[model samples]
Target: MESIFHEKQEGSLCAQHCLNNLLQGEYFTPVDLSSIAHQLDEEERMRMAEGGMGSEEYRTFLQVISNALSVWGLELILFNSREYQSLMINPINEKAFICNYKEHWFTIRKLGQQWFNLNSLLTGPELISDTYLALFLAQLQQEGYSIFVIRGNLPECDAEQILGIMKVQQQQRPKLIGEDEAQSSGQGSVLEAGPGVVEGVVDEDEEELRKALALSRQGMEVEDEEADLRRAIQLSMQGKALLGKQP
Candidate 1:
């Protein structure tokens, strides 16, 4: 697992990190996912409009990741889907898994004969033994993660090739980057998914959406500051602000 590809936690782009890690490269970016999600959103919006209805869900999340990944001939099957469950009692013939809990996304992929947890939350990839794999998947299920089994050929990598040639022994297991601090603070750490504060995309609609979010946040901050100042002036006029005695 020494050559394991991992992307550390960066902003709320875990979905981006997860997909890229699963593919073992920088195959995706936040803008890339956003454009795909926006396309999906547009399709859903049009579909709803055809029925004289409006959309509810944002739908600018992993649904876009799934769509984008499909270009490489990768198929993601829900672990809880009846189709997969009926076919196998445990995960078999799987290359990788995309796990989501809350809005955070991560990957677990089998490189060569061993599986590795390529979670961005973790400092690095954690080695997973074959015997412990089933238990780990069950634990994730119990912890409310939606697991998607990835099927189809994955891009070849140094780790996969090196491991395929000869397996490496793990001397230590990797831990979440902020495991101790999060536990002490009584917080559950998560890197949110979806279109976020990211760079512009080539897609016109996607760029427009990202610009809207940025402008809206900026406008809100300006308005909030103006409102606060107005309130302060009003309070001084009413003799409520006696500290500076400017009134």
Candidate 2:
């Protein structure tokens, strides 16, 4: 006898089986659930909600998306946290995007709420408080683009790991090629003495000081212009005292 599953519906039976296995230790694969109906049907609702699913984290997630998602006629398939950000399907394009929480409006999509909630759990509900998702959402919303949410079928990630991804994703765009080339050209000269280093010789002020001190030597043998040299040293020192070290 042919099973009722084949004749009656395409996805419902497989989804039920997948959901059952998911509640057990068996992992849910998209391939396994592909032919199944959306598992968010009301019968799977749990009464023994224990941890974060019912906690403030979930509440904050709700508060954020409450304006954009609805609680009606939708089921959330709870999974462990993963590395990716979660998303709600766009109503127009059917693509997924990071969601925005407003006060009281909801979308026409069934999976949108669950997707937001799942992403909230994975990325931390506080992702709503961040500017990156907000800005991205604003851009998408303005552009009429849709975004898909990544449903986590994976394990929990640490804060450091999650934040590192966020930081890289949030970095500013790099310099343009023209600007980069210009900057390189500006700095392309050979490394030379800067303000502090004397070019090709010892510092003039230090040289003058050495000459003045040397001219004061009692046993000097130079006869030509030793007095002139002494006077020149005095003049140089006086100039340095007035003008300070020059390049």
- lDDT top scorer: 1
Q: Deviation in angstroms for 83 in model 2?
A: 29
- Tell me how many clashing residue pairs each candidate has: 0, 12
Regions of candidate 2 where Cα sits further than 4 Å from its true position: 1-28, 38-129, 146-155, 158-247
RMSD (CA, Å), candidate 2 to true, equals: 30.7
Across 49-103, the per-residue lDDT of candidate 2 in tens digits comes to 1222355443543332322122222233221124222544233322123332111
> What are the TM-scores, per candidate, against the unseen true structure?
0.64, 0.19
Q: What lDDT, from 0 to 1, does candidate 1 have?
A: 0.61
